[model samples]
Target chain A: MIEKTLKGKPAYWIWLAILGALIAIGWACYFRQYAFGLGLTGMSRDVSWGLYISQFTFLVGVAAGGLMLVLPYYIHNYKAFARITILGEFLAISALVMCLMFIMADLGQPLRGLNVIFFPTPHSMLFWDMCVLWGYLLLNVLCGWVILTAERKQVPPPKWIYIFVAISIPFAVSIHTVTAMLYCGLPGRHFWLSAIIAPRFLASAFAAGPSLILIACLVMRKYADFDAGKEAISKLTTIIMYAVIINTFFFLLEFFVGYYSEVPGHIHSLQYLFFGLEHNGEVYNNLVPFMWVATLFNFTGLGILAYMKIFKVFDYRLVGTAAVLIFLALWTDKGLGFVFAGFVPNPLEEVTEYIPTLNELGITIGVWATGFFLLTLLYKIAIGVEHEVEQ
Target chain B: MMDNKRRKFLKMAGATVLAGISAPAIVKLSSTDAVASGGGQEAAAGGHSQSAAGASSARIRLGMVVDMRVFYQDQALLDVAIEACVKAHNIPEIPDRKSEIKWIWKTGYENAFPEHSHNHRSQILEHNQFAVLCNHCDNPSCVKACPTKATFVVEKNGIVAMDFHRCIGCRFCMAACPFGARSFNWQDPRPFIKRYNPDFPTRMRGVVEKCNFCGERLALGLEPACVEACKGTGALVFGDLNDADSEIRKVLDEEFTIQRKPSAGTIPSVFYIV
Candidate 1:
């Protein structure tokens, strides 16, 4: 079951070591969750969700973000995407794996998760979200794998797969949108109750997720020789810029609604998140200010990409810097109180705060490292396929 | 002294076991097969809708009316009423602090409604006393938000009922409800349930629970435990909202009464005369 080497150096061992360390960390932290229960996390009765769920939400969006790439490549016949569309699909599979892992970690009784499917309640957004994310995960993996295998063998891919990829675009959007509905539908929770939440979620996903893919492409080009060509790279950057614009626009609308409405419930959480209101006490501390800086970094990064003449070469340093910022900015905004801002000052006017504990932080790191390890392995096999390496 | 104390404890324990073993058989032998229905005249159509009952009554409207002004005078009475109801309903007392599971209790003046306060601590009177359990709204949003029909408004009498078996503990109902009526059970209930009440349904962990207006008691034509325990002034009144001749209707007609958070547009079945 084991494959030995890349370039005969047993590079797979390096990947195995990294993955093993992550799994060990995951096991150690998991024991704490079992012993202490959910109390170990920052979640309280008022703030039912925290960083773990937020990351799951963001990661699902990223998995769907691949649709923006997949659609143009398959449906519209964009030749530029042809070289690296398999990479996008591979990225999506990894994103889906991370999304599921986060969901599993968030549950109080991990064994009970099967109940969501067994007793399917159509009225619950979570039920739909569970179904859609799972469906999208399967479609992308199967279709992407089949197509990649065919390409490796110098054979024609089954014509039906194009239809599957085509079907996956809107289906992918549905996966993230349903996840958004889980929050947006609540009436009193001002932050999440927005009508624009589903759209905003999709927009952010497109920007954050593909931006990740573009970063991954750039990374591969540097360390390995999977150079998908400058033309393709330029095209991906262009798409990333456009997605970022959508993401920026979505934020603008969200901010406009928050400030203009003047409803204390709606406005207070956003204020608490950004301005550090109420003596900058317990919950709203260092990270609240970072939201503003995140907006700036995202805009500035998008601006650099938009103004093509400024950076003629598409320098790796500039790309990496901008990508890292956009990634962090979105992560902070989505994965923290930005999504939670709506829920504070609950209908009862009780302020329950959320701050991820050491155990929660450790569990999150373990999950992330596991995701990267799986991603590294998948990409290795894929690039090996493209290069016609022997099995 | 230690030997005497141990003997005393053993004697008490022996008596408790003797009572426990004989008490059930005595009751079963004495009582007939008939289910006890306390004497209350039913309307021609019965209390609740037959479709909802699937067995017993027709459409029934369950409701409550509390005289808040009078409630402010008594803390001991309120505690007794809540304790009685908790015992009758088999509700647990799990003490995680955060997940405070309460089927019925006093919400003193300030804590009951913060927006309506005239002074800093208007909710708490000279002593702790205020609004009683859930209002059980006519258009209960909690019912609307519950993905499973776990939490529902029984159509006949409009009692908000929770089917614990179906509940997934998503807490969406908690967020959607304006009254903050619902409570989540963070831990299992078995450890905390001190006594068994055959009339009321017991809850599981993670599912939401709240005041059910003592639907089981009302079904048997008995007043809710809270109503029976309120004593002297009789501050708590359980009745059929649809009946114009009921005491609840009389209070609504004569007194300048109000429902909690009326602006919420939930049209609460519970009313209060301050």
Candidate 2:
């Protein structure tokens, strides 16, 4: 089963080589960060978190997005999803690995990260986030391995696997909820301190996670003799459409509250991200263009999906394009705008702009490469087993 | 037979659940006790004579009041107090403002009281340089956010303190702090220190540090370095807020004081009379 990943075509090997090289370069950059401190990054006292944490937050959503397929298949007994559920689980495993790596990159003392476990503070949301993330990762590995192996052997998975699946349904939700709480519980960070953050995180996760899977399915059908089935794809399209709508609505609710109340603390971050903020006759807003791009992509993606739903259009190409757009839109919104907004008007009311240094970008690229590398291997194994069973 | 097997499985499951739930609770209780005892030993080892005298008494809530009017009159007095604090604490003098670690710093009234500052505000209030430090809040968000108990409120004196050795420097405390009181040593602070106080210890790279309300000095029956330096100038006052006769409480009673982001509900011990 493990050797299945080694027996791929020339293109597969080339793709793996590219990811490996990127990972190597990323590690080289990370060692520099370790030798120096986070000072190597563009983060300052004002902007303590940078690209690393933002990526961590975004990937957690991507990881949680796996449940969009998991819940429908396992809980709803949707047989159409059985063909692709393993892919979702493997995607989660890869995303979570990247999430943990991103966290390690962000920590001031990466070696002492175990202190979080050794001296656990339940009061801190970070402690719970660690617990849930590790738990979710374990659940996915166990479930995916057992189910895929059973399929290869042409047997029904043991009844106990269903229990793990049930637990993972809520466990998946917990991972993103706890991640959101990491930001929301902080008192001073007005952008993240909203009760709506958890729901918004889930909505975006459901939208982006399945969209990634749809794109993966398309690639699998093209290259690996695996089809996620048209029924599964259409169901996912419906799920993405509704989830994207809910995500947009939740964001608008936040905008309404921030702008309508006109509280400086609540509005300042939003103003800085969307429109440039003017302080002491100096306009400081580097995020304006990124914010507008995300807004355009998100709504346009939503409009495309809504049109498909109304017209009952089942064109996979158009839906796939929309999925790609939605994926990028949420990725930018969560990974770029969301994290930066929380720290923009630093607690001292000083606007210290943050632009990621090349080193930071290198390290981030390395983490993403690592995730994709693992993802390719995991998908190879899963698709190999499915192909063997089909034969 | 089926009933017996079902009963056996249920009992086993319930017992496992009970054990799992109780295990963390027990550890939590014991750790809390450990922390309480550890605080006692710290005070004893540090030999805070004043705390020893009041060991059996009610917990003291230490507070500070800054008279911005005095600092406004003579900016040098503010610098004197800050210099004294930096010297007494061995705070690093990182030349780069991006990575600077500050125990106390000067900022304009607009930055200090951003919510209060509006367009067309008086020039005096706008231009006034106010000294801001950790408020040592009764409900400190930093202590609550610290995963390792590295930043905690002292049980004896209510001073928010840091155990630099234990800090993993996640900087969650920095984010949690509404007052921007905490600072992370982004690099080795030793080389950056222009004047190191041998009595005070310099922190390592990758640990957050902030104003500990001069907890070490108060332990030795002495005033905070900043308070002592500003004594004649009357710009800074430090006292037990719980004690009615303390100067901090007296000033609070006589003057209408404002706290930084009081609406945040941190119950900041530091007050200002603008």
Candidate 3:
């Protein structure tokens, strides 16, 4: 089935070529960054983490969000998701790849990253995060491949696959929970020190991951001639509605606790995000505009998604726009606002705003391209196999 | 000639890898008696809580007392203290504060202790500077966050030290520290050192480093460079906090000293006499 990638039309090859160029540029930028050290980027001592970590956080949600599809299709035995379960698993595999790449890109010594494996500290949440991410990726790869292959051969998937599938459900939840623990467990950064962080991560992930899948299904239907059935698409749209609402409510819950309680630690980080923080007689709020944009996208996406579900309207174009909006909103919330704003008024109560340099953005783009490349390749295999079974 | 040189390089690389594997054992054998424990979490626990491990009575918890009143009288003393540590550790002089390597540095009082400064204070307290360094906490969050135990609390003396080689440069320790004590080598630091202290090994481009409380100087029966340099003003005092008769303990007995961010629950060893 790997041969399917080679069998694409000129447009497909052109897309591959573009992705290849981006990956190459990213690799070169990473090498330059590795040579010059992490200073090539805009990260300072105050804001030690930047775009790489932010992207890694967002992608972790994406990887776990696939569980949205897996739980409904396998556990609840929702027959509508049968044709699309493979898509969710494969998307997870791709997202996990991007998560890893972003993490590697962020490391100052990429060569020594294996020290985590060499001397594993059980106390560190990072060690657990690494373990669960790799575990979830392996589960997805194995299950997605074996089940898809079984379908292509016109045989029922092996019975043993169900055991792995059951284990994967909790494995999905663990990846995001441990990832949240990465920030929330830290002492000084009051913004992330919340019990609700894991829940917010999951809610945002559920909405973002499925909406992305909706767009991918539409793309596949138009390009690859693979329709995943109207029943499946509409059901997924409903899932997005619930997830987006829960996610927004979670954001509001954070605001109420932080502001209503009037705790300076909690209020300052929130203030830094939604409104600019006044620090040392100067207002530092570079992320303020981005946060508002995310808010605008969030409610707009919510309104459209809500309308579609409320009126029993299932127009694919409007749904696609809503999906794209919801995807961007969550990406901004998790990827940009969550980590970026959390670092403001750092441990020393000094606000040092971080903006990623072009060099950093180049590396980030490269990682995303590589993820798409893998996703496109994996998806090509799945669709090709589907095209074969249909004939 | 090129093939011959390649083979020669490969042989040397193999030898270096072999040496790397055995270096830990050699360092343990040759290092200070406490480092023989290699800063293990179990030993650190024994040093902290006597009942937990019933560890030896020789488990000394070193601490520092910074007399901000004395230091603030002569603010230049803060720079002197910083100079002493920089000279001792060969910390690089990077102009960028964010990426600069600092073993010991000064921060404003309000920034140092946000909880303590929430209310209006005496003008002296508001304007004064505080010398901040690693607390070598009773429960060090950096040690817990470090995925490879690159930064660990020494069992013998309760000094939190960094092992640069073991640090994967993840910067998790940086995020973990509430005091902004840890600094990452954003770039190769050798070029930035004004005057290289050959006595100390310079950290590589990609690693985290911070105050070891002059662990090497302690082994040599000398006080930490900052404490020694401040002997004239008598602003910095270093002694075993566990020892009841120690000067640091006496200072705590007499003065109304406060630790930075007491609510953080790290139980910092460094105390400030406001």
Candidate 4:
């Protein structure tokens, strides 16, 4: 079964080689960061978390998003998802790997990462995050492999596999919720302290995760001779549509609470992000354009999705455009804006701007390449098995 | 044979579930109870005696109170105290503001207490500066956020301490701390040390550090380095908060004092009197 990945066309090898080159470049930069300490990155004492942490946060959502397919397919008995469930699980595995890599890359003492397990503090959300993340990854790997093997054999999966699927649903939800708790539980960061953060994280994750899958399916259809069926795609598009709506609504609720209340603590970060904040009459605003772009893309994508759904019209081009737009919108909102916004008006009541250095960006690209490489290999094996079963 | 295999699988699953349910409780009971009971005995013993040896043997809730009125009058006193702490801790002097590591530093009143300030506040209050450091809070958010107990509260004393060897440098503790007390060693601190203190060991790059309340000095039956330097000026007072008769307790009872961001519910042991 593993040999299927080796049987790909020249295009597949080229893709693998590109990803491998990016990963090698990333590791070379990482070693420089390791030698010089985190000083090589753009993080300051005031803005302690930069690209690495933001990526970790975004990827956690991507990892958890696999549950959207798993829940409807397994619990609700949606038969259309059977062909693509393995894809979702494999996507989750790759995303989790990236999440862990980003964390390691961010650490000042990367070698001592095992200390989280060696001396666990249950009080820490990070400890629980570590537990659930590893547990979820194991569950996905076990279920995906076992179920795929059974499919190859043309037999029903073992009864125990059902338990794994049942457990993974809640586990997926917990991973994102715990990641949100990492930010929300902090006292002084008004931008993240809201109770709505966990729900917002979930909504955005649901939208982003399925959108990535839709794109992947499109790629698979064109290149790998795999089709997840139109019905499956339509159902996923509906899920994405509602999720984007809920995510947008939740984001607006944050603005309303911040602006209407007019608490400086609550409004300061939003002011810095949306409308440049004035500090000592020296107006400094870097995030305004990025945040506006995020807002425009999200709402426009939402409108497109809603219009299509309401009219009972299925345009693949329109749907694909919406999926890409929504994915980028959420990525910008969660990955780029949210993490930095929390650090603005830092604990000292000073606004210190953070922009990632080239070194940091290089490492980030490497992590993404690593994820895509794993995703490609997994999909190749999954599609090959499915094609053989059909024959 | 098939039925027997199914029975075996079900039995194994039941056992796994049972173990999973009971593990947390068992861990909680053993770890918490042992540390709590042990800490209790030490605190009781430390309270009865004010001797330095006794303080070392038992738990002491080390706290500090700064008299801002006295502190603002003499700028030299603050400098001497800062100098002493840096020298004692082997803290590096990174000229770069972005990467500088500080155990204790001076901050303006407005920056220290943003939530408490008003537009109508007097110029005197606005202009006054106060020395700030780790609060060693009763409910430290940093300790809770640390995935590894690398940064942990000393059960024997109320000092929030760090194990640099164990720290993974995730900076979660830095985010959790409201006072901006913690600093990361962004680069190797050894090269930047102007005058190396052979008494204290310097930390490697990539770990979070802050004021340890001079835990090393305290262990050696000595007052904190800062307290020693600020002596006779009556600006800084360090004592055990657990003992009602201690100077820190008396200062709290007599003067109207305020802790930085008391609304944060961290219950900072450091207080300020203006």
* Native interface contacts kept by each candidate, as a fraction: 0.19, 0.71, 0.80, 0.82
lDDT of 4 at A350: 81
- Which run of 10 residues does model 1 chain B get worst, by summed lDDT? B34-43
Segments of candidate 2 deviating more than 4 angstroms: B1-55
Sorted by DockQ (best first), the order is 4, 3, 2, 1
> Could you give candidate 2's per-residue lDDT for residues B1-274 as a string of tens digits?
4234323433432332223223455433322322223232343233122433244455567788898889889889889999999998888888888899998999988888876778888777877789999999999998888888777776556778787767888888988999999898887889888887766667778889888777655543456789888866668877678867555677789999888988778899999989
| Per-prediction tally of clashes | 15, 1, 1, 0
lDDT of 3 by residue, B1-274 (tens): 4234323433432332223223455433333433322233223334223323223234567888899988868999889888999988888999987688877888888888877885778888888778989999999999989998878776556778777767788899999898889999999999888888766677788888888887665544456889878865669877778767666677789889888988888999999988
lDDT of 2 by residue, A9-118 (tens): 99899999999999999999999999888888988899888899999999999999999999989888999999899989999999999999999998888888888988
Which is the leading candidate under DockQ? 4
CA lDDT of each prediction against the hidden true structure: 0.68, 0.84, 0.84, 0.84
Which regions of candidate 4 deviate over 4 angstroms? B1-59
TM-scores for every predicted model:
0.82, 0.92, 0.93, 0.91
lDDT score for candidate 4 against the true structure: 0.84
Candidate 1 on A1-391: residue-level lDDT in tens? Answer: 0141244235556766877797788769978875655667776666666777888888887788787678778888888888678777877888889889887776655665676776566877777887888889899888888887787777889888878877788888899889888887765566777788888888778778777877888877766557777777777677777777877788778777878987655677777777754622555544566778887888778777766635575766777677777777777777765556655665565566566788888888888888887777777777777667434
DockQ for the candidates, in order:
0.22, 0.53, 0.60, 0.61
- Model 3: per-residue lDDT, tens digit, A1-391? 6887789877788889999999999999998898899998989889999999999999999989899899999999999998898999999999999999998888878898998998788999999999999999999999998899899999999999999999999999999999999999999889999999999999999998898889999998888888999999988888998999998999999999989999889899889988899987999888888889989988998898788877888888988888998899899889988988888888889888897888898999999999999999998999899899989
Candidate 1 residue lDDT tens string, B1-274: 4234323433432332223223455333212111111101111112222332333432346577787666667657777788897798677776665656776766655446644655455443535666557778887777767665556665545677666655666666776777677777655665788898765556556567788776555433455688778744648766666757555666678888666666667788887766
Candidate 2's clash total is 1
- For candidate 1, the per-residue lDDT at B263 reads 65
Q: How far is candidate 4 from the true structure (C-alpha RMSD, Å)?
A: 12.2
Candidate 4 lDDT tens digits, B197-255: 76666889999998988755554345678887986666887777876756667778999
